[model samples]
Target chain A: MKNDILTVMWKERKGLFRIRGRRAQALLGMFSPVLLAIFFPLQEGVEWVQSPLSLLLAFVAPLILVGMSIPDSFAGERERHTLPTLLASRLSDRAILFGKMITSVAFGWGVTLVLLAIGLVTVNIAHWDGHILFYKPSILLADLAFSFLVAMLTAGAGVLFSLRAATAQEAQQTLMAVLLIPPMILQFGLFAIMGSDSGKARLQEVLGALSFEQIILVIVAVLLVLDVVLLMAAMSRFKRARLILD
Target chain B: MPSGIIFGFLGPNGAGKTTTINLLLGLLEPTSGRAEVLGLDTRTQPDEVRTRTGALLEHSGVYEQLSAEDNLEFYGRIWRMPATERQARIKELLSHMGVWERRKERVGTWSKGMKQKLALARAMLHRPPLVFLDEPTAGLDVMAAAAVRDDLEALAGREGVTVFLTTHNMAEAERLCSQVAVIREGKLVAIGDPDDLRARSGGPRLEIVGRGFDENALGLLRARPEITAAEVHGDHLVIDLRQETDTAPLVSLMVSAGVQVEEVRRGKASLEEVFLTLMEEER
Candidate 1:
């Protein structure tokens, strides 16, 4: 099973790369860093990585961005109606499904890494008293790998939904709901909740109390569990998938 | 009779043909039955089926950016055919499908006919023992459809490849099919040799084409009680003879009637006719 999945993925390596267009590449590159820049806007006149939100965004941005690739991965094939051809091949459903999932997650990581590179370049170029902004390069890289795990979670969820939805639009919408809700809550709702709270000092204390290492481990744990759970769901629920209308 | 028997699936639009094809390929699970290919149950060994057989669905596609040769090679690799074998197999398929000249061109730019032939080449690239095709020539022009038909028939006869063909073209089915299975909605309404199904469905139906016969000659032929039913098919009249009836009486009557009998054929009804009969039976 492992060999079959890997073989199919390798065979499709060229075509899959071609399908990941410049738009997707650009989106992936910009998403992580831009989120970081937003949380710690460069124009805000703060050091690149000092802003907790920006630092957190950079760590979590890849996780969120990875999910975006999932909807397209499975939904794209469903939209093109090519699922049957693959299903009819000698490879089993689980193998083909997992192969697609792995490929999608790989792309998610690939794009996130590209963004990471871009972020590192921009941060290094920033004039920080002739100093690098983020102190934990190793940590960020580790977080990027964690983001890859989170991407597997999102990809698995997207594929499960994509299998049944009659049209790509529905599959995308289904995946979008799952992908967008959690990270979006973190992205937009965090500030909202913080602003509405009158305990400004308490929030500051909490922000300052955050140990970057703790956040890294927490995210990693969550990402690992999510990846395993969602992957299991996607593989198991595949049998129940019926082609449904938008 | 062999390990894998290629059954031609015939039906009209919305006749559950694609549904059946999907069931066979393990794409959609049977509503309440079983699908096994090569001793590997779809429910148990889907990957096994996928690796063993190659399929070209009704609306299969390839990345627009890649050349046809690349598509073949890519799928070949997925089937785990070694690089050297894949190269030789792809070359042979491209040459045989008559797309060798344009193999370098991106599939997105190919004509409908070119793409159909390329799809066939891709399906056969791995040299899978079993193949499932859904309306393989649904959108191809006459020449291209004919070419694909030839490829499929030759694949079955020469290569001994099992081709589970799915199509709505009655004439094409009759031309190439060794055995046929007709489905309606979701039920297997008929299954057997094309000739047998046609004969049983229409009950020994026959068609004659020539000058008209007078009632006296018809009466003489009918006196034997061999003729059961007859109908007009275009310019000629179709006659259905009773079981165990000989054709000598009809020929004698036609000759005596001074009618120029240009053709005397015993046609076990056509696929279309059989399907229509099945539909009527269902109704």
Candidate 2:
């Protein structure tokens, strides 16, 4: 099983950038994140590394990157008529699922790490003082955990959509829409709560009671649970019989 | 059904040829009955069956963006062929298919025939004991189809693998398959050797190339108890026989009646004719 998953990863690695017209799209998709990595550090100077500003790049980069990849890895195979042959091979369903999920997560999380490094470099070069500035240990840890979890979240959700989608574009569009819902709801909930003085007071009271570390830990724990739930859902749906029919 | 012969599974569009192949591969479960491949129950041991078999499904199933070598290389890895052995086998198969020179080019750039050939090479890369090909030559031009057919025949012969081939091309079935089965609406209608099916579908036939075929000669030939139907198509007289019988007496009768008989050919029905006859009978 391990060998089979590795074999699948081997193929996925080759196909990641080599697919027709995908290179251009991938480069174009990287443009925004690249810009953020450079522009934010230059604008914010030392705050980019010491504060939570870099976390934005960490969260959004993996979501977009993994979003672009998981659909293509899953639905693109079906759209191009290769999934049947792959499923017909000696590969078990779990190997295929984990192989694709791992590849997408690695690509997304790996690229986010690079972008974060680029931001750090941009900040140091822009604000060259007596010493080089780097991301604070806490910020760096949060960025890593958040980016990795977001990558997993996107991959898990993307697989579910890809399994039912007829085309890669459809899966991608649907995944993006679904990913937007949580933040949209959070924004609305925050707005509504802050709109009322009493509600805002209560929120600040609750927040004031907890340390930043506790809050970060709580969010991480929630994301970890969601990631596991989505992964389990993807595994349950990734049956060979179901995929063949799809 | 045997160990090392191409068994042709004949069916029309949507006649469940692909479905049956999926079942045998364990990609789809049998709602009722069960199947076994290489003595492994498809229901209980499908992975084992798939490990021992290869398949070229309805589609070519090749990655168009990847080079041909990469395509075969990926499957070679899937089967866990060692690096050296996989490379050598890829070279051997691609060389045999006469596409080794073009192995570095993306398959999407190749013509349909070439892509189909590459897909074939991928299927045979593992040298499995059995391979299932679903309409392997389905959408190719005449020359391209023949090229694929030749490759299939040579590879199957060289590998000594049992090929479970599904095709509507009866001529292809006749040439490549030692035994054939016809299915319609998910049920087996007929199963036998090509010759046996041909003979069973229609009786012996006689065609006489002559310039003096007339209604009078046709009438006399049709009156014989052994002849089922006789018709003159231009200068040729075609006689459908009730059974295999001596044609000398009939030729002598035609000559005595002043009908010029230039050449007489005795033959059984072709596989295509047999397939059509079976379909018509089922209807």
Candidate 3:
């Protein structure tokens, strides 16, 4: 089983950037993350490393990257007419599922880490006041754990949508729409609440009751639960007979 | 169904050929009956069954963005073949298929025929004892189709592997398959060797190239109790005879009736005719 998963990963790695026009899209996609890595540090100085501003990059980078990848990993096989052959091979279901999930998470998380590092370097160089600037220990931990969890969330959701999608582009479009909904609603809800004086005071009071560490832990726990639930759903949906019919 | 021979599965569009292949490969489970490939029950031991067989399904299933060698290498790893052995086998199969020189070229850039050839090589990479090919040469031009057929025949012969081939091309089946089964509307309509099906569907036929095939000769030939049907096309006369009817009497009767007989050829129905006849019967 381990070898089977590794074999699938090997294939996914080879074909990662080989999808038609995908390399160009990837380079184009990198532009924003690269900009964020450089721009935010220059604008915010040491505050970029010391505050939660970098967490935005950490969350959004993996979500977007994994959103772009997991669909292609899953739906691209069906669109290209390669999934049946892969399923017809000696590989088991879990092997294929885990292999694709691992590759997508790795790609998304790996790129986010690189961008975070680039942000760190930018801060140290631009703000050469004294010692090298680095992300605070708490922020660093959140960036790593949060980015990873987000990648998993996207991958898990991507598989479910990809199974029903006729093409990779369709899967990506649907997945992006679905993923953006929760965050969009949250942002609007925050805005609506902050618009009122009572809501603002009540919100601050609730937040003030908890330490920063407890809040971070709460967010991490919620994400962790969603990740497992989505993963389980993906596994249940990844049956050989079902995929062949699809 | 036998070892060391090509078994042709013939059917028209939507005739469940692809479904049967899927069931046999254990990619889809049968709703009613069970099947076994290499002594492993398809429903119970699909992995073991798949591990020992190869399949070229409805689509070629090659990664167009990858080179021919990489395509084979990926499946090779899926089968868990050792690196050195897999490399040697890929080279051997590609060379046999006459695509070894272009192994590094991306498959998407190649013509459809070339891609089909590469797909065939991928199916045979593991040297399995049996392979299921669903319409392997379905949409190729005449020359390309013949080339693929030739490669399939050679490889099957040299390796002594059993091939379960599905095709709509009757001439291809006549040339390659030792046994064939024809299905219609999810039911087996006919199953036998090509000759056996031909004989069952039709009778002896005689064609004589001649002039002076007038109505008199035609009526006389048709009136014979042993003859089933008689027709003429310009200088040629065709006669379908009852089983075991001697051609000498028919030729003499034609000659005496003033029909000039140039050449006589004896044959049975071709596989195409047999297939059509079976389909007509089902309808």
Q: What is every candidate's alpha-carbon RMSD to the true fold?
A: 4.3, 1.4, 1.4
Instruction: Extract clashing residue pairs from model 3.
Output: none
Q: Chain A TM-score per candidate?
A: 0.71, 0.97, 0.97
lDDT of 2 by residue, B68-123 (tens): 99999999999989999999999999999999999999888999999999999989
Each candidate's lDDT (Cα)? 0.69, 0.92, 0.91
DockQ metric for all predictions: 0.40, 0.88, 0.87
Return the lDDT, model 1, position A198: 64
Looking at chain B only, the TM-scores across the models are: 0.88, 0.95, 0.95
Lowest-lDDT window of 10 residues in candidate 3 chain B? B237-246
lDDT of 3 by residue, B1-283 (tens): 7899999999999999999988988889899999989888999999898999998988899999889999999999998899999999999999988889999998999988888888888888899999999999999999999999999999999999999999999999999999999999899999999999988888788999989998898999889888888988788787888886778988998899998888999999789988999999999
Best by lDDT: 2
For all predicted structures, in order, the TM-scores are 0.81, 0.97, 0.97
> A3-27, model 3: which lDDT tens digit per residue?
9899889888888989889989788
User: 1 or 2, which is superior by DockQ?
Assistant: 2
Higher-TM-score candidate among 1 and 2? 2
Error of 3 at A157 (Å): 1.0
Error of 2 at A26 (Å): 1.5
